[model samples]
Target: MKLKTIIVEDEVLGQKALAGILKDFCPETIDLADITGTVSGAVESILKLKPQLVFLDIKLGPNTMGAFDILKSLPRIDFSIVFTTSSELPENILKALNKYGAKKYLLKPMDIDEVVDAVDCVIAECGHDGTLLNIDQIKNIVQEASQQHVTKKVSVPVKSGIEFYPIDEIIMLRSGLNNTYLFHTDGMTIKSSKNLKFFEKQIIPEGFIKVSRSYIINPTHVYKYSKEDGGTIFLTNGCTASLSGKYADVFFKMLNSST
Candidate 1:
């Protein structure tokens, strides 16, 4: 089936560029319905056209409000969004991935192969389903993403290859000499070859905060925070870690922001 798609981009060049890419690479799978430059215009086009997919640019206008505002106001979300952005910062990338629950994020000055892959992934995932997506599912995805909640599972590298762990089952991470150990809520620990910095970048968007130089703890699993011993955090799984005085202020700020 030819997927109906719309491009919600503010830049004229970006719109043309993406349109050209779709025409060249995704001719068979995608049918471009319309293109709009603003959030209101995009929303109206989306509702009227009822497209199966959307290529949405992240920075629409008004620094504070963007595509997400448009998404939040929509009565129903039946199409999948592939967010496009120019920012390569980790925090921005994380917000796009975790908050928007975007099917794919294409960095600006779009790559043809990446665009093709995103389109292919969407097409493959929507195969034979009457509706590509629905309101309730989108709402849940947005909520979960906003909370930095994990998707169902996470892959952790092991000696052999990789092991899948339930995101919720992870409690904390502690750095050792050269490796980081993942502490699970169920009294199980897994050693990862990557250092704390690697895991920090990977999981920071997934609700894990680095409270110290050697520890990254999942706030959901945190049982108590005691300031007595230079700041000690107790997890629900009977694990404890000390928070560095240097990171305490920022850590609390992040905690408050998440809440």
Candidate 2:
């Protein structure tokens, strides 16, 4: 399966540098999919890329609303978000948030291995049919996402031997005519730069539901599920997806049983 990837860095060097590293590191199934330098571009690329993984810079633009605000607004994005910044590690400001017991705190750069390891956990969690997201409820959800939300590593085959990523942690798949992207939500998003749908099937049975023709959401982290007229589905995250009249009943039934 191709692991689709994207980059959302405002810096010219950062974008080129990361893409260069990915090309050199995981060449077999990973491909450099898309690039965006602004908020509007980030949002558009996210919807269009549906990437399984994304490399996002924390701060962008004069407003400095920050890159995380992009994901925060689209939490259902479920894309593994890997933060890119000059900072060596998570700041004290975020470390403090850990006290709240929610993994909502953002990840700061540490090392390439740290990222590879996180992706590995995502792959491992993808193997389950049911997800702890619903089983654990609110408290558990917050805690899991915070510190222990690890996705097991899987070797994405290449001459480089293996590029490991937690296949299960992947939350969404973004696609393009010739490329794809994967987005994960476990503190960071890992990028592969390949055919995302191929990996999508691996985790589909594990709470990952296709909400739109292009968007696939992980049921594990989904908090809202409202069925609207004309077969549209509204998520707790405020994102709307199609539940075509033909599939609405089955979709709700499945979500109901899981809940």
Candidate 3:
């Protein structure tokens, strides 16, 4: 099925470029529904047309009517979105976009092949009922993409300089009074002055799970889960961490989804 698509961009050149790319490369998969520059117009068009896909620009207009605002104003998000932006987005915004079921995040001066790939990925994953994507499917897609994007390394700030850790070598994180301790697979531990929340926002995208208020673990290194001991998780590196009952349900849910 051809996805009913809309472009919400203010720049004339950007609009032309994106539309041209879709026409040239993704003609069979996408049907251009409409194009609008403002958040209000985009929201109205989406509400009226109920298009299956949207190419949304971050800066629709002033502060009150940004792309995020349009999403927040909607009663329900039944359509998928591909965020088109010129600037590199902040981590918080990226997390929000992923949470809001964005199908893809495209940087401007867009590449035709990337556009085609995004369209193809969306088309291949959509439901047969003509619903392009639901929240769960989008979350899975975003999570997978995030894992791929963060596979190689993670940069951590240290007192002397920055330290880079191979993502696979990391075992888990333990929260401290005002800092967080990172345990590695190679019998090394590093303490960063940043809090658990900081590391959570940074590395959770890389498949780390917060099993409790003070512990975030790499499921890849999980040796065993001991339910008899109030849900203690033992790592492959002979380290143990407690999984709180309060967060157990969501932790298991995420674990199941990943598997």
Candidate 4:
């Protein structure tokens, strides 16, 4: 079933680009309900149409808070949101969007394939009926946006698209044949085409240590360390990873610093 969708972008070019993409590639999944630029216009159209999804821009005109204001004005947020913006979203705002039922954001200069994929994802999540988030949930999201806490996350590229995971939830990563396997706290393993080196750069800043050339481990998920067979570390998932002697000192130091 096609999702009843609205576009709330300020720029005329952005509106055309997204609308054209949707009309061209996402006709099967999206039913364009309304397109508006201002907060008041968006709110009005949203109320009148009761769309299942909205493509919102973070900055509306000179008001940086316009998009948020439209959300706050709503009686309840029962639909899904996909934010469209040029700048990297603040961590707090990202967290708020996630809480508000937005799993992804489209960067400006939106790609057609990506736009179609995004709409498909939202349709899968929203369904024809749409997911219902209460007013209190909306308020909490707004409150979170007002806060300054920056949650660190890792964006993993997959065949389907991108997956965002909290850094702390990753147990460890093991490299094999130019690909990387990510083990999560939930016992989920994601095999990515991205090489280990690619992920190393993304996670190292969050305290994940490269214990060996083939393995990177989040010390927080280290269940036990063993000196047997040179050195080895057991993860919470009971998977053991080699701990190269060269990195042992640095790894221990990192663990010490974290504690």
Candidate 5:
């Protein structure tokens, strides 16, 4: 069966990029339902889309309170959640995604093949053994994956100085060759010498994530999440950003790792 999905991201270019990638990659497997980039947008989109999966970002704009507020406001939930973003402050949000239990996740800046493999793995596991990825198991996978791949981390030396932001420290890595920007829990951004791909190698196998084509965020930073075009995220640094459709799978695994 095709996966019914929703994308909730705040960035515009990021939004289009998601659609484009899906078009080329998982066209038949994904059925795009809704898209949003703000907390309000997320709520509205969810009401309409009612997707089974959501790609949510951590930074929702200037503040993350709205994202949390929206999640609390939901009267009921029937879908699985996937968070995306660049800060590592909200442990509660991660716990909530597993509140009902579901799949582990798919990291970002992810190749279409990897994503398809993860989803295929999930479905196949379900079909073969009726065993699925629970929140806790997903957590272990992320931790193990993160540890196995983190043999070498490239220091992000840009901007102010040759600051070293560990892969785990980064909450969000912007798209393109603009150098990966790490969004710390304190809300400080650390620039990298290379691009997100440098870090992707480390996180994609285990933890860390890319939520959109232009942005990659850490799973640890997610506060709250929803399914919508503007998937809302409340961060520890009091920041919020909408998760877009382009990054749906990336968001899922990031949150799965933390939750």
Candidate 6:
């Protein structure tokens, strides 16, 4: 099915890059609707065209409000989103996007294979049944984004579905061979599809500290710290995680600053 799609990017080059990909690779699946750069123009075009999918960029020139403003101004979100972002974009914004129902994200400079994969997924997801946010949820997302709110919950994508964990309920996270394991206060460990670095980016602002490459611990659950055995973090859950020398200085600095 050819999806009526729009590209909402500030940079002329970004707009052309994705547009070129669609025109060249995905001509059968994507019907290029329109491209808008400014927040006002995006809002106007989206309202007029009513596209099924939108390729949205996080930054719009000097407008720090970014894509969230365009979303907020819209009447409703009936279309699915494929967020286009750079590596430099903050993780909190990434969290916000996921929190509000964005499932597809593409990092720039865009790869052809990844772009194609995202479009195929969008057609499948949006074609059958997909998550779309309402105006109220959009407002909350924008508010959090603007205020730079530290999230209280972390969403972990699992094999079955997404799992939501209260930040306080988490004891520590350990990196496994393929995925990350999350230890909670309930004595259950949930496995997340994302890596240690993914969780670190999302939860570090919420007081979860990466004590080692293998582990990230919630300081609120710290029972004690022992300098013995190289270094180790003792948690209230009666679990101990090894602290690596690599992150020891930063961890120590955090402890010192909190005092």
Candidate with top lDDT is 4
- Clash statistics: count for each candidate: 0, 51, 0, 0, 35, 0
Model 1, 120-238: lDDT tens digits are: 88887774544433455556655655566344454565778556676667899999888889998779899987667756545676767788999988888878889888999998988
The Cα error of candidate 5 at residue 242, in Å, is: 39
Superior by lDDT: candidate 2 or candidate 5: 5
Comparing 2 with 6 on TM-score, the higher-scoring candidate is 6
Writing each residue's lDDT as its tens digit, candidate 5 over 45-158 gives 777777766666646777564444445445555555555444332233444444434344333443455456545554454344333344454455344433443323434546
**Model 5: residue 52 alpha-carbon error in angstroms:** 1.4
Q: How accurate is candidate 4 locally (lDDT)?
A: 0.83
**Where in model 6 is the C-alpha error above 4 Å?**
1-4, 9-28, 31-37, 44-51, 57-68, 72-79, 83-118, 125-151
Q: Which structure is stronger by TM-score: 2 or 5? A: 5
Candidate 3 lDDT, tens digit per residue, 69-102?
6775666678778998765455545666766767
Better of 4 and 6 by lDDT: 4
Per-residue lDDT over 204-245 for candidate 2, one digit per residue giving the tens place of the 0 to 100 score? 645567655555665655555554565555444444555555
RMSD of 5: 16.9
The best-first sequence of candidates by lDDT reads 4, 6, 3, 1, 5, 2
Off by over 4 Å in 4: 128-131, 151-259
Q: Give candidate 1 misplaced runs (Cα > 4 Å).
A: 89-101, 127-259
Residue-level lDDT for 129 in candidate 6? 61
* lDDT pick, better of 5 and 6: 6
Specify the highest-TM-score model's number: 6
Worst-scoring 10-residue span by lDDT in model 1: 87-96
lDDT over C-alpha atoms for residue 6 of model 6: 90
Q: What residue runs in model 5 are displaced by over 4 Å at the alpha carbon?
A: 65-67, 87-110, 121-197, 200-259
